[model samples]
Target: MNAADAWKLACGNLSNSESWWEKVIQAYQEPCRHYHNVAFLDRKFKLLDELGTASDMNAVILAIIFQYYEYDPQDRASTNNLAHFQEFASTNDLPQGLRSKVEALLTGNEDDLEKNANGENDVQLLQDLDMSFLGLVSDAFLDIIKLERKEYDFMSDEAYNAMRRKALQTFLLIPNIFLTNVCRDRFEAQARANIEAEVQSLGK
Candidate 1:
């Protein structure tokens, strides 16, 4: 199914007010999002379903739903996206605990995630949910990264290499990319291989 249809399915599953999901859909349609658009969300949900990491259905849905709400596809800034999600949660009277977890995943900070490791299952599931996109088929991963790279082609080779090296560093720093055991088992080696290939390509 397309992004709109998949989003409708997610909204139906969440049982949230139509207006809220509508706002989310509109936010995703914003012009700046080449990679993190509806298709991205759809792939994430599909992975969650396929890998069985969707333990807390509502949180999983919300986590994925609010992922890009404050995103400025052009600038790649998420400050507003994060704020808007919190506002939406508060306005909807969602539990603070649940909202917190969703926010953590949206924040996507390695240090923050490590510190917030109190709820092991929930946190792992959320991590796995987000990382699932990285576990896509090799060509798919390259395609998405290429799409992201298109925006940066004007950069000097040195600058681009710096960005690529930073990406490789990030992959090395993560202890385990996929959090859920099943996903970890399925994609861990593949993730490593993909990183290695990218690192080699960058000659870093």
Candidate 2:
């Protein structure tokens, strides 16, 4: 599904707001964005549909919608996006509990991952969906890397490769890249192979 269609699926009985929807669409359409655009959301929504295991699909979809709301290459922490999402949630009258859950998922810290391993199904599914790209076939994975690199075009090749290598290494260090059982079974080996290959190439 496209971002708009995914939003409708997520909203369900809730009234859809054209202005808010447009704001989200515009944010993803921003010139600097490449990998984190509407197409990324579409992939995530497809994964969510395939997984079909989130306890709170609404919260997962909401997190996907706003996770990179205003992505900035310099802002590795995504603090601005989180703040903007909080405001959006408040203004849209989202239930407090759902809002909090989406915030936690967006943060995606070690604590959140830990919680997901400890039975937080919704968080696990969302996190796994966000990371599903890492497990794509080599050509597809490299295609995403090319787009992601464009997002950081300001960085010199050496600097960007170093940063990319570190990020990929961090994932390799993790025992299991994908949290959910289904994701692990489907993606773990391929994800490791892809990351290892990219890390080696970055070194060259």
Candidate 3:
């Protein structure tokens, strides 16, 4: 994966890096190289231009996770989305070393899930719940960004919807949120849809 993709993966796995790693190993057979891509640099500059070096890591993580729902790792992406997440996070004005930690987590989790699932040990279901919660946080920000872009002059609804779709997906992935002011004030409906769909999906 490229730098942008690495950052994206990192953000998607922001909390509970081990979970991200487990899924990543499931997606690809082997690990790839190190180094952030060029676009990552550009992303950082663009973010700094806007947020001026104090960009919210939570919001930024949400944004990257939003991108995660667009592509299916079941395809020929070579590796899982960890690379993509890292790419986006490193280049943008988000936190440093977060991507690295996530990568490490991904590497280590190669056997944890299977062992736990196979009854090798009891599972901390709450930790899994937190991963889902992160996705909900991702989705909440997606709709908010859509609404904000609409407020930005000359932005089209078409583009905004695309963004919203991605956010909704990330939100659906974890399907949980601790609670944020903007989440309740806005994006409540979309969040509900994500939760219901995820629940129904698991039921089936």
Best by lDDT: 2
The lDDT for every candidate, in the order shown, is 0.67, 0.81, 0.38
Q: Report the Cα RMSD per candidate.
A: 4.4, 2.8, 14.8
User: In candidate 2, how many clashes are counted?
Assistant: 0
lDDT of 1 by residue, 1-204 (tens): 444554555445444557787887787767666776777777777766675545455555676777666664346653566777777776667777667667776676334443323334655776676666566678987998787676465677788888877977798798988766777888788778777778888875
TM-score (C-alpha) between model 3 and the true structure: 0.24
Backbone collision count in every prediction?
A: 3, 0, 31
Error of 1 at 202 (Å): 1.4
TM-score of each: 0.75, 0.88, 0.24
Q: In model 2, which runs have C-alpha deviations exceeding 4 angstroms?
A: 12-16, 108-120
Query: What is the model-wide C-alpha lDDT for candidate 1?
Result: 0.67
State which candidate, 1 or 3, has the greater TM-score.
Answer: 1
**Ranked candidates, highest lDDT first:** 2, 1, 3
lDDT of 3 at 87: 56
- Give the C-alpha lDDT of model 3: 0.38
User: Candidates 1 and 2: which is better by lDDT?
Assistant: 2
The alpha-carbon deviation from the true structure for residue 61 of candidate 1, after best TM-score superposition, in angstroms, is 1.3
> Residue-wise lDDT of candidate 2 within 14-100, one digit each (tens)?
544566788888998999888989899988888778877777777778888987787888776654777887877767787877777
